[model samples]
Target chain A: MPETNKKVLILSVNDEDKDIVFRPADTLLGVLRGKLGLTGAKPGCLNGDCGACTVLVDGIPMKSCIMLAIEAEGHKVTTIEGLINTKTQASFIKHFAFQCGYCTPGFIMVCHSLAEKQPHADKAVIKEWMQSNICRCTSYQEIEEAVASILAEE
Target chain B: MIPVDFDYYKPESIEEAARLHEQLDRQKMLPLYYSGGTEIITLLRLDLIQTKAVIDIKAIHECREHILGEDYLVLGSSLTLTQIEERNAFPLLTSVSKEIADHTARNKITLGGNICGEIFYREAVLPLLLTDSLFVIGGPQGVKILPAHEAFQQTMQLGRGEFLIQTLTRKDFLGMPYMSVKIRQQWETGYPLVTIAALKAKGEIRAAFSGLCSFPFRSKRMEDELNRKDGTLDVRMDRALRHIPAPVLNDIEGSAEYRLFVLKNTLTDILTVWEVEQNA
Candidate 1:
């Protein structure tokens, strides 16, 4: 703990700013799931290609897998755990936007960010933003319907 | 697949970053500059990047300058792709940046990373290629600004400890009508086999492409030929392709034959856009 103190980071996650220790090259996805015990962001591809580990940094959707935990210092990061009781998560639940539930957190994060950017996101923008979060079970239509519903509510 | 352990440092100034880079190079640690961390993590996981130390340059203020000067726009290297997309300051650039990847990755990927990123899909560079953009490279000797084309082509030519600071492009170029396009067999998220960008500037059509050749480039002569409307559009495209000897990227996303067809289609599509714009 003393040695890792050299890599100590104070990050704002889910409206709570906490001090966390992470390695130099450790990804935010790893730190969220491994150390802090926030398993909301999934580690699907572990590359920027797959958006399964999506989170909101400073209120914008980002792939946590490609972002270093050390780089996340002093930034606001929001995961699916932060989405508890939110309308977007409720929409996902209602529309059955998950099969295995691995990609649900990431999809919810993306939709949440989309709503912030475009409070009433049209179909084109929703279609464009959902491309990164891949749903292997082919539940994309339901997910899109969920996101569109969230937008409609806004 | 975890990347090997590395040390991270965030320098506050360009001089400090350059000094750190030079020091690391002397120690044979193979230091890599990092900003946004999107490319750094992906390449590291793939074992493509084997550096011992990673320097996060986002802390450097000099590299984060995004300003619209009277004549040019100084786009900071650390500006995220999402920031560039939302910046209605450059509408064509906005659309192009949005098409780069998905919204999530865009939030993590930076403009400088996309430009100096060591990847095949440096699609954002196409617009800068069409304009007279120059790169301000910082090193121990000092900050030396080089034309964007020469800097991009001669990245290996950069001296030790040298890195790109920011880009300066004429602000008026952003106002010129341009079309940024990509032909990806896979929908939205696929790396475009051939990303084409063409703009009408100074009363002449200029064009650039990525993924069609070994590197991102443009063809002024091809733009001229496309504008001529001589009965040889198809023949001219074929000849121009052969002139540069465009090499198709034969990868999982596309085959060489498919890439060639995409390049041809992209160039022809630009001509059609040009025709429509000319009439309008």
Candidate 2:
């Protein structure tokens, strides 16, 4: 055991830099939900198969479950809690995109990143990007409609 | 979350990383190189792999190299699949990477991580194999460059304390007529039933495959048979099928027979499309 196992991570979550102690093996999702009490990013499948733990790291959508907390030390992590009064949220509300809501945070995070990164995303591009998250509670139609409605703004 | 605690080091240079790995191995620490950490996190949570030290190589400059050289394209191992796809320096690679996982996972799954991953469906290596790219490996003996064909046999033959830094592919093969197709068992996202990558170079077709056998491979014999000028497309394909490198895989995604069936159709389609391009 080397002396570098425990680390004090200064993570920039939703634009605020917070300090916390974490082990090298601790995942970002665990630290966020347990230590920070930011439970927006749901933990559905610990595996990367389900994108239920997706968050934006440096403006890129990344599954927090698959990412080590220590790795996010210098990057900006934008969780679902970070988003407020955005077009994506408004569109999701108007389109009735979510049901049961277990996967909404992850879906919203991915959708927000997509809208910010590729605002003019076409049908094919939208399908490709949004395929990252899985929402089994409701039909994919409403979710796609929500994303499409926001992308239409650009 | 992973059940065990391990020391993590982010080395800024390749030599420092190699030295750290050697030191950790010498101390019986069971050191492992960490990149994207996607597969590592998943496997660690299941207690499938254990390590006392993790050397994070993502900070190394060499592992972050992504450049289009004068005659080659140098891509670092730590570059995420989405980054590669967005750059589109290599169309065949972009196509293969686009189908590896979903977009979010790709944002985390790095090139080297996928190539040297635990999962068998290493579709990202297909294009590198087709182009005979150069694999830059860093180890205790310093850096060594080997052709991808030589470095990869069923899987990357990396020695202890050795890690991939980046891959170099000749620019000539970058723009070659190539086709990358991954046929999933059910939908567009799951593991491939059989993924085929074909590149037409020097008026001859070169090909590689994944999910067909136990490991991804580029069979010279199969390519030779497929490139034979005397036989019709069917005849050549039948002969090429005889040269499959190993017994086809029979896994939950698909049975071996079904995989071969899909593989044959895919190979035929690729050949037909390339033939039309050649005629045009």
Candidate 3:
């Protein structure tokens, strides 16, 4: 029998341990959504251009599609599912930050990290952080408001 | 996701990384060094490159070092663009890197990855070229230090199995008066129409360019023309434009003619800003 290249990856996703078999070529987005059933990170563009698959790796926002599953071995992978009831989520609801709801998870993850990292984020800083994600629905105004409202509370 | 499976090895030291590359080559594994892996992953998705194995060099200590020595600032190749921005060890580098990609993508793009990448618009190398930085490379030939300009032509000219470990810039160069600008086609989110970085050292203006041509470059003739005290800024800029190293790039981002037009304005802006600063 030919030796299989697949290996067991013990991942810490959403503060839980998951041991899943994966190939080295599999992306973090693929493993999270396909293997672990953590489908919150949508695979839009699959390239790094779109932030639909944005997730927090050790509190820093990363595009999951570009990041390999093996790279997430020693780090804490936080998908939108990991985010329970958070201020960014609440602010998104309050501000109506979505039209089609496809980009909300990715935007929420980025905004959530921004709120934690820069609690006093201003307009410039907010724009710098939020520019990574794209919303085809043109809901950037409401998304900006949602992020601004959360940062204001902080 | 990459369509094909490849063996992944994480090497702890430069020697180990080099050895893995050699061994993988002997086994016909077609190994490639991985750091940041943003470009590799992106290109892999498009079927642009193929590899049977990958050596992840991020675990090597020297490749992750970001230190400020008394005489130099040593930045590891694997250090992410975001890390560089947050550290801001070299203000010019920070400014140039800030405009490379959107904020989140910068979190994964690294110094070595940007410089050694197949992507033509290697905007990060502009500041390094202006500073005359040194590259620390490791491979089957062992580690050696080489001047960035000598080893980097259009791309990093590395021997087989070699990879860039770190970049060392003179501490004095870090604080020099500098300007960096990136002009995009439409908005700030996409790739650049033209990106220019300039630094004034010892009463001379040194410049490098990207997106204006197929590859990033620093031309001696262009700098000489720009620095000539005999001509006005407009004349000097026109002369410099004539000496551009290659045909201006014309792609989806911009046309060759439009790129030259934008490059002229950006160069004028740099000169104008620096002129005021120098006089003050």
lDDT of each: 0.80, 0.91, 0.91
Question: How badly does each model clash, as a count of residue pairs?
Answer: 0, 0, 0
Which candidate order results from sorting by DockQ in descending order? 2, 3, 1
Candidate 1 TM-score versus the reference? 0.93
Q: Candidate 3, overall lDDT?
A: 0.91
In the range B1-280, model 1's lDDT, one tens digit per residue, is: 4558877878888888888888888988798888887777878888887887777788888788888989989888888887777776777678678888787788778888887778766777777778878888888898988887788761223677887788888887888888888778877666777777888886677888777777788776666665565566687677667655355678887888888887788778877767666779
Model 1, position B236, has a per-residue lDDT of 67
Highest DockQ scorer: 2
lDDT of 3 by residue, B1-280 (tens): 6888788888999999899889889989998899989889988888899898888889999999999999999999999999999999999999999998789999999999999999888899999988999999999989999988987998999998999999999999999888888899898777899888899999899999888888999998999998898879999999988998888888898889898889998899889888877789
Better of 1 and 2 by DockQ: 2
- In CAPRI terms, model 3 is classed as medium
- Across B1-280, the per-residue lDDT of candidate 2 in tens digits comes to 7999888889999989989999989999899999998888888889999898899998898899899989999999999998899999999999999999898899999999999988988889999999999999999999999999989899999999999999999999999988889899887898889999999999999999999998999999999999998979999999999999899999898899998899999899999988987889
Q: Which stretches of candidate 3 lie over 4 Å from their true place?
A: A1-6
Sliding window of 10 residues with minimal summed lDDT for model 3 chain B: B1-10
Every model's TM-score on chain B: 0.92, 0.98, 0.98
lDDT ranking from best candidate downward: 3, 2, 1
Candidate 1, residue A118: how far the Cα is off, in Å: 1.8
* Candidate 1 interface CA RMSD, Å: 3.9
